[model samples]
Target: MMAFEFPGQYYEVIRGTLRDVHAETAYLADWLAKSGKATGGRVLDLGCGTGTTLRALAARGHGGVGVDASAAFIAWATEAGGDGLEYVRADLADLDVAEFATEEPFDLVVCLFATLNMVPPEALVPLLRQVRGRLAPGGHLVLDAAHLLGFVDTYQPSMIAHHQRDGVLLTRMVHTSVNGHTACWRNEETILARDPDGAVSMHENGFDQWVLTAPQIRGALAAAGFRVVAEHGGFRDAPPPPFGKGPLVQVAALDG
Candidate 1:
């Protein structure tokens, strides 16, 4: 179990600018509809940082429970409470779906933004099995992970980004190291934040992630009793090669 920790306050401040939440949510909705799934379904969001995506889903009539290992993220998300939304702080490896079964089984389980890469390769099958046990009859799981090529192309040796919003300035410096032989990578990140009152803060964290291939992911899903239904290149319609230079997005359903 790798610890994927981030500065929650800084993350929340810059998340909206990091990606297009509306577009991502729309893409998810479209994917679900294309798979013949219904709207207004319950969702379980694994590695839901700051609950941005879950909040967007709720606005479109879906209810969701967001789980993250970072207490800061959970706290920030909980503070921004919305209808049909709940936040829980728990590591994915130690998750117990039974605790969230009060309503009904989840219609969809999402592990986005390469969150699954944080899970140790050996634990993936068991985690998938756990997710399978908590899904509705027609439930589906959608996830995105960094493939070998993507990792190589996207994660440079070092990079820096600066963002300023709402009287707060955030600077993130990232250093990435790739171990091709092991298909693993480590990211060391340092964050510098300047608040409205001119107070400065610095935070540092690092985590390791595995670069999985399409076949590897499919095999893991199959081992967990799931049948791969769709594979895409970074949320697009076209499928990426097994070792392409983009995020591998997959959708799987229980193999009955």
Candidate 2:
């Protein structure tokens, strides 16, 4: 495994780090609580790592189900589950979560923080469409992806953007190539802390992530039968070039 991939060592460090999951917490709790009038339904957190969002939703008095692909993360989430939360290790690229869909489709489906970038461009359409099918009428779809214009300097893209609490050091490297349909990013990470004290310390150990452009993300969602609702620059109607450290966030609604 390369430094720019989800390496095993990085996972162990992540399990120890990632203390405060406020980002997802804020998104889920706020969105589910005051997403306009009354929808009266639970929420689904896709690619939910450690079931943070799921637990957050539960805290907000809503039933939440978190889904991820990493078994380790899933197990951690499951242990963290219960008390009105459920975490499943299912491939979101191809999932049949009819049971949690409640035979009425989920009221909200979320894919936050460029979770879509991990998947290939080809799989996006089908994935979104499938998710759309599991959404109830008048439900909302909020998916996020990487922002293009946000990072033009590939060589010196960004420094070791550290997730201090998570003991993570993230380094990004953009591919020296681009196209209208596809774009890629290379993320190099390092884990710098561990349990049992000085026994296993890391000067460099972490995972990687590939990002996508705004257009590519939008096109995929539109093709999946979603109506462009409101895509803010950043978290809350920020500004252009809404990616990078800004965490390019997009919130859309699947139309029936």
Candidate 3:
């Protein structure tokens, strides 16, 4: 299996442009408040690439840690440090909550943007159990994952996007394929960077990702002692069949 890794600076710039950080932060805050959670509470962000979400939360008086397996990502996030945010380099599959013993239990744990889908099948349940153990009572776990319906409807087998800003140009190509319950993704990025001296540099990188189905994810959460409290299609609350036309966003709480 190919290990997943971020393609560094150029990719981050393009990704940041693609996502609306403020909107996502607002959605998270609103969801938590409506669920009866405090506004300025501790948050634990898993697969937090570059810590943008945590940084936004910090501005709202929230504090927390961001965890990712990418050393490059950790370094970048650490450099862009927030007032009360810390970045840790660690793999979620083998996460050690003991490392965070000094801090209070997290009020919210998030694995957004289909990050949970990247967890290997064998480690999915164990990771969920670990996450459950780290949450304070009444705390919630919010995550989004790929599902068959969504994948089929939205992501084409092959697609490309381009963006240019701040003397940098990025072209990203996405290829996807599904076999059984697993979806395989390959991302190819080409970057052209211009310098003040009228010189240009080019860089290229590729990454692979595998995603499982919504039922598989829900089952893992249940086996890890969580009960689904709310389900949504791309952040908006929706009725079940849960596997709608968008990513499966689930809010789960510890079960009795």
Candidate 4:
């Protein structure tokens, strides 16, 4: 079993594989509805893994642009998107957001699936502050992050993932004891048989994701000049238990 990291080809794979998960879709829909009422305005999918959330929004009639640090993910997003929906390869921290936002300001900017927790908390401030400046007054910044309770489960030896397109072996063996902020994921992936002749290969990978708590994420948003609007416990139409599995915390805020 090998570990994997994101923001590269692996990000593309994960994004493609997990694009339409039910719980994630539910989360995407919630953010889209709030942002889609802008009558033809733009929405920004920040730290967009592979533009899944952007695609979801475009399907709802909202124009979308996907931005991420991953070159491969951007390439995939570009190839996978339509006219109103496009992907850009840019660091969230370096984008001249004012120039790229088509509708003067973004009605909504969404960063999904614990994307915020992967970064240094301090770095998140400037990045989100830039996003805030690009939002129209009363517009929102919706970021889905792992609830502190998300890691309630004890580590398992491994997990098997098999789909029509691929087969995966995920192992969480390496623990990032660095401030207990990160979880290192080790993975082994192999593409399914797609050629008449042998053309597939298995690849090993490793990556790390720093985890953040709900209070920390909220405070970071606040420090970036945002006003907290609401926080749903998870996407199950019910509040998350104090500590539970796959806990996703949604933070909605307005530019103050």
RMSD for all candidates, in order, please. Answer: 2.5, 5.0, 3.1, 4.7
Separate clash counts for every candidate = 0, 3, 0, 12
Across 1-256, the per-residue lDDT of candidate 1 in tens digits comes to 2343555667877776767778778877775565456477788899999898888888877888999988878988899887889988887877777776475678888998888988878889999999999877767899887776677667689999898878889898989888878777888888889999999998887788888877898999999999988887766677866545656679999999
Measured on C-alpha atoms, candidate 1 has an lDDT of 0.81
Candidate 2 lDDT, 27-65, residue by residue in tens: 545555555413345677888776666666666666757
Model 4 lowest lDDT segment of ten:
169-178
Give residue 238's lDDT in candidate 2 (0 to 100).
57
Output the number of the TM-score-best candidate: 1
Which stretches of model 1 miss by more than 4 angstroms? 1-7, 34-38, 101-103, 179-182, 241-243
Instruction: Go through the candidates in order and give each one's C-alpha lDDT.
Output: 0.81, 0.60, 0.74, 0.60
Decoy 2 TM-score against native: 0.73
Q: Which candidate comes out best when scored by lDDT?
A: 1
Candidate 4 lDDT for residue 151: 44
Model 4 / residue 26 / CA error / Å = 5.4
Model 2 misplaced stretches (Cα beyond 4 Å): 1-24, 34-40, 98-104, 151-163, 166-182, 188-190, 201-211, 237-247
TM-score of 3: 0.84
Q: Model 1, residue 121: what's the lDDT?
A: 86
